[model samples]
Target: MAEKKWPETWQEVNPGCIVFRPGSSRDYHTGTWRAERPIWDNSKCIKCGICYLFCPEGCISEDEEGYFAADLNYCKGCGICAHECWPGAIKMVGEE
Candidate 1:
């Protein structure tokens, strides 16, 4: 019998079936699924980097001014960053 050819990547898998792949989430744009998005209040932000550390999607990045901002392209808006922020710099707002 011939050896079975298994899918090596997420793309190779059939549609509607998600294959677990290491670091493969970056290839897909899943931010649109978010009902709410994070907004940063720089004035209240302490630049402690707490939001960046708590972001589950890893979409938060330090901007030029040293404040952490979420990349809307990949941010799922789970509100984790906002929930974890102690300074109340990050707020989750409903997406209009």
Candidate 2:
């Protein structure tokens, strides 16, 4: 896969001032939700490498910053990445 570059801002803000409906599982409601982007808090990461070692598809990589990330093509959104992120650095969050 080619190197994917993220925008300078980590999380983009929603445009409209509409209120977000309560609850976490917004699986169906849609306008432009794309895929589950893996989030990381670099300070929380321990560089333990459990997520990389445990990924069934071997889709995780350690960047120069020492945090792990999943390669999207092979990540089936299994939530295993979230489960195994020991320091809570990696999480599966919806994105558009």
State which candidate has the highest TM-score. Answer: 1
Please, what are the lDDT tens digits per residue for candidate 2 over residues 34-83?
Answer: 26766767788898888889876676799997877776755656667678
- Report backbone clashes per prediction: 0, 0
The true-structure Cα RMSD of candidate 1 reads 6.8
What digit string (tens of lDDT, one per residue) describes model 1 on residues 1-96? 222256446655556764556676676788989999999999999999988888878889998889989899899989999998998888899999
Local accuracy by lDDT, each model:
0.84, 0.65
Error of 2 at 84 (Å): 1.7
Q: What lDDT, from 0 to 1, does candidate 2 have?
A: 0.65
For candidate 2, the per-residue lDDT at 23 reads 42
Question: What is the alpha-carbon RMSD of candidate 2 to the true structure?
Answer: 15.7
